[model samples]
Target: MASGTEIPAETVAGRKGALSTVISIDAMGGDRGPAAVVAGLVLSAAELPDARFILHGDQAVLSPLLARAPTLAGRVDLRHAERVVTMEDKPSQVMRHGQGTSMFSTIDAVKNGEAPVAVSCGNTGALMAVAMLRLRKLPGVNRPAIACYWPSRNPSGLNVMLDVGADIKAEAADLLQFAAMGTSYARNSLGLARPRVGLLNVGTEEHKGRAELHQAYAQMSAAASAGEFDFVGFVEGSDIPSDRVDVIVTDGFTGNVALKTGEGTAKLISGFLREALGSTLLARLGALLAMGALKRLQARADPRRANGGVFLGLNGTVIKSHGSADATGIAAAVRLAHQLARADLANRIAARVASTGLAGQDAAATGAEAGTAE
Candidate 1:
């Protein structure tokens, strides 16, 4: 039996009749516990009128939290979980003994057809492990990826990047798969007809980078026409948030480092801006006059506004939200999940990969030497 207390069949049936889409959420996996989760749900419920949620967590802790938010009534169905997978838990341990946890319950709902997508603000490694174990990889996927929205100067105001941290290394064929998967993501999430793809390298010159990158470059170039994307050859780190490319493809180690670096740099810049704005009377006066513009800038740079990193290349969609996310961040993650679920992104990615035959192109060379991801 599943560990959590199942919602009564009558209740679920009634909910299914009323709601257009169901999103399964792990209520206890976040650092803020169920309070932030329920609060975020309240926000999501208000924005997504036709959506309902299956919240998994300790009933004792969640019941009161939900009671405090009257707006969430009838929109949320709580499942009682006896335990939680903590940030400190190893992925291996969680995979073996996480059946009773809220995180596992969250993924199981999607696996059982109760929800089309699952959202969890938990340990990234553990969440990926559990999700892969339960949902399994999509056909022709070797290493699943975590794609995130990067603020960019594109018309859509965003770009897609993949393998943020699903695994540390990706072979040439894997990078090829990432490009195809990212193209599908941009099409669905960013509404791009044909997104521009870029391979991360030390320079724009194709001659640079490791041997695997050279192979990936050729593969991406060859596959771009069939994949329905524009391969921009190679891009530097500066191009990540630029309009020059709509998808920045890299191995997980480099991607994860770049992600954290970008986040830290954003925070640092915000702090400097605050300090400079308050440094003198004249600066303070100028700040007041530009408050509206400043607010817009802050909104654009806010990490919480772009909180979800989607786990791509899986049979089912899973959103890995920031572990320390507050209500606003959690709401953003939920909204992203809702968007992807509506778009049927997973199957689209699978179809894209299969169509291009990217997954099977280099099967015999899967174990060959590749670039040093670190």
Candidate 2:
């Protein structure tokens, strides 16, 4: 069992009414191809026994790998494809030319109800674009956002952030959409009620923002007043550590930078610790004294926990992990996908939007003449 502090108090309550979770994984879509993802699928399968697995990729490429791991072969159904989308390809190019690509096939399967969730560590851009264009919105959403669950220093509940690396050039309306979408995500996925919403601005001041920022701020402010959400105002990147808010909102570009910066920082610190502990026996002894503390810190910093990113607002669940993610990362992603499917994120989001009667219109949110979101 995980240490009490290492787990959330809500885990038990959250697992009360679990749903049937099935996932389709892009078996050969990441930087390392099928090897790492297949290993992760096997690991996740053992952990999530109820999660049926369909591994989509080039049969020839994956068959040999699975032949070596016969145990995995018996568990996973092989879904064959021809082409593979590369890491360096343009989003549009990959979507159009990367026909029969594992990522596309996996997403298609999830959308078609072959599975409840799809996990990909491949071309993130293509995954988001394809999920949006294909699965479309889940009833009341305008644009789908990338949702990452953040572990807080408080350890009470996981914070959710969105729009990471999707629309860097997003406008105010887009940010507001992200906020609403995030609110829905927090409620549906994390089971947080009246989840706190925050705008990731430079400062907490109402006036602190860019041109688009000002517009988005005003819109979200009105939404809060209208009782649409529990909007908590602007938040700085520094506030991510504390449990000040349940959802941090921003545009795709800004959110991506924040997410990458956080990831890089974690890597840098971990590397520094390894190097420090390796150099001398004296330092190693010092590390040993603090091994428990170090494990706790490292566990908190582990990318595996944050590896899964939800493509919020989609008709179906699509998860994106880091482009360089390996087997361990992929395994965590499948677990997260299972968690999301069990939570029924899409349906919850739809219900929240419907209850607000806002549905597709947040015009009044824009502080405009109550027109479109713009």
TM for every model, in the order presented, reads 0.91, 0.84
Query: What lDDT score goes with residue 180 in model 1?
Result: 85
Model 1, span 1-374: residue lDDT tens: 12112122221343558525688999987888789988899899999876789999999999999899999987889999999999999999999999899999999998887787899999999999999999999998888999998888888778888889999999999999999888777776676767799999999987999999999999989988777788999998899999999999999999999999999999999999999999999999999999999999988878888899999999889999999999999999988887776666676677667764543222112221111110
Query: Candidate 2 residues 156-265, lDDT tens each?
Result: 44788888876666777667767777765665555554567888889988888787877877888787644357778889998865687888888888888988898788
Error of 2 at 357 (Å): 3.7
What are the lDDT scores of the predictions, listed in order? 0.84, 0.72
Q: How close is candidate 1 to the true structure, as a TM-score?
A: 0.91
How far off is residue 24 in model 1, in Å?
Answer: 0.5
Clashes of 1: 0
> How displaced is residue 191 in candidate 2, in Å?
2.7
Q: Which 10-residue window of candidate 1 scores lowest in summed lDDT?
A: 365-374
